[model samples]
Target: MNSLKRIMVGLDLSEMDDTLIRYTAFLCSISEIESVYFIHAEKSLDIPQEVLESMPTGMPADEKLRTSLIEKVEHYFGPDSRTQVEVLVVEGSPLKELLNLSKVNHIDLVVVGRKFHMRGSGLLAQKILRNGRVSVLFVPENEEPKLDHIVVSVDFSDYSLMALERMLTSALTKPNVRITCLHAYQVPSGYITLGMNYEDFDKRMQGFAHNKFAQVLERFPSLDGRATLHLVKQENEDDMGELLVVEAKRLKADLLVIGAKGLSAAALFVLGSVTEKMLRYNDDIPMIVYRKENEEIGFLDALLGND
Candidate 1:
């Protein structure tokens, strides 16, 4: 999770590809990435007879697409870039192709477009987020190429710690980058059963949360300037995820990172509830959903069988 050697950028034939290309190049310039693959999946490489007859280029659909993507990479990624780039044009279901290619190529990260104020339905991003085992970076259409501030949602769980470890060991661990572990807690109604008043229990809850954060921070000296922000869930605050998105925006965070609790899509990959909730409410900020990729994905076989 720390050393991201290779990555795959999912490209759709849209304006969003321009943004993804630039952002991915910016990432390679900063990180120690060795290889990058720009992949686009088409339902079919066959063009209708009428369509082929009216086309500007006589090349096959797949070859033309590959040339266009390569040109885009050369334009934004630059010819002198250190990273080795490849263009893959696959024919099949987009989701199936992307998932299979990533596994076959041993990709460390999957970069996909998170359409906001764009033409896409954002369905591909969600499907990739839910089904892929590798880490995913969801870049919105208008997202800038930056990684200054990273906000990680924490509940003092191992899943949250896994995410924080990634940031600490990631290439963005430079002095300029800032990482904040945000935690949201609620004062239980049972606190009153312990013979403490509402105000007394509230202060106690805050104290407990601070102690936990201190312990967690003590384990990582690299996070010296790192701090925690605690939010008390109000009676009517139905979604904690909304609060996290709000605070991250308030801090002008460039990326949101979280660890999904389990490997199953039903368990919420790259989400751990934070991303699961914000997927509905968030529109602008990019998010990095970290999850453990199982060695073998039976679910993928099911998806492929659906074809």
Candidate 2:
């Protein structure tokens, strides 16, 4: 009901079947959401025209399923709620349909339910992260959402800046928000590392990282210097993924934001060791991953299927 005009939630029959609906309604009430959409996508093989004709609305049974989904969603949120509830059943690709709905409906935030392993499904999540325009909040099955401290994994890249901007925009209404801006840089070592003094390298890198963070802070002057700045230099090893989780847990951050492409499985393998390995398996902390515009997403090709 605040300024988050549209929130699109992806609902499916899974372990956390109702998690997205509950979370969406809760956020809608707090954000002053105008309308709430519960979209369910069904993957099907081929169907004869006769079957389609016999179905309600001359559509697939999936389309008829909208009625039940609507009832279930409303039951959770209750009929007394002010937010208008709309249920849609689209017969096609899941992510593609969701993205189109978001664009057409002017969705502000996209809520997705994330399940462990499931092979191909993880790829679907990756595709949504890569292709969708809305900010994606990946909620694990059965895990409650939290908003205590936000951990930002910053690489001082333009992509990271985009994620930071999202964080600032989403966090303003929060009365007390603790932000940890983390940067991990390599400190040259070994014989080549010995050629350059590690101390001086550490000093310059720390100053540079700190300065970049300061620039980001300036961008959001309203933050009023409440954020905690962190600069981490890797002398012995460089494991971005492991370090981020370790530090986040150490700081007890409730939310985490990181650029999507930066943490791609391929990028992690080539760029260096990354935190993605941990993220892929761990769902303890809810993560908001931002995929920038113009990024190619072959991984998400399945999500755009037949749409």
Candidate 3:
């Protein structure tokens, strides 16, 4: 229902690569995905001119490595998979190639793995989070995706609403999936400087959060008794991203959903601060970064009010 027909998965030939493939396969089983492209970008390394000249250009070392990697990936999937799979081995920067492939193929979702070390996949994941145009799912190592308890971050913005809509549509397809809408708010610094009681300020903020939650729920009548709303008060020194990670761990959430951008105007096609921070802090839970739809504006409309 969310229109995820084509998914591109970046493979780094690590142990986590299998986990990512299995997760994508699971998603394909549930959704109507038509194709899954498993791609590996072989980084070009410096070599002596004589050594390069000695090797034939017909089939380079990278091409051989790519062929081997494709064979390995195919062995993992075996021949029984119902989904159509394609394996590609390209030579370039992994992040740049992945972004370009997604755009060229009109991919709906891009799946990649995240590791604890910041060497290969971890660094690539960070770049994708910041620059990728399409939706991305960062699957953690050694974790089977259950998607049982999902925590979606909301700020009542259009991007956040897009996340909520995607989550609801996906959740409706899964059985016994628990959805929690989390909103983290902080009192204005001015209020604290004004000598307002912390307790009173917290109470007022809680009331406001409750009203906002109600209004959000009013927009989606179908989620009346299905999803639960959670409000968290942010401490002066606490980061909203860290708070979200803590809450997700407490909820034992298998998946976390967040908008790619925030309410800020500058966040048009970039990762919002909170989303970026969360990816940096947490490496265990998988996350889905949902992007808002593109609405085209004409040149005349941009210059004047109407044509």
Best by lDDT: 1
How does model 1 score by TM-score?
0.89
Can you write out model 2's per-residue Cα lDDT over 125-230, one digit (the tens) per residue?
A: 5555555656677776666655667888899788788777766765234657678887777765552545667677677778888788788778877555677687
Question: lDDT (CA) for every model shown?
Answer: 0.78, 0.67, 0.74
Name the TM-score of candidate 2: 0.77
How well is each residue in 180-280 modelled by candidate 1, as lDDT tens digits? 77777777889867999988988887888788888887888778775555454545456777887887788788888887666444653445465768766
Model 1 stretches with alpha carbons more than 4 Å out: 48-56, 226-236, 263-274, 295-307
Off by more than 4 A, model 3: 45-63, 75-80, 117-121, 171-173, 189-197, 262-265, 268-272, 295-307
Top candidate on TM-score is 1
Q: Candidate 3 at 68: error in angstroms?
A: 3.5
User: Model 3, 3-60: lDDT tens per residue?
Assistant: 7778899987677787887788777766667788999885664434464453446676
Give the range where candidate 2 is weakest over 10 consecutive residues by summed lDDT: 268-277
Clash totals in order: 0, 7, 0
Clashing pairs in 1: none
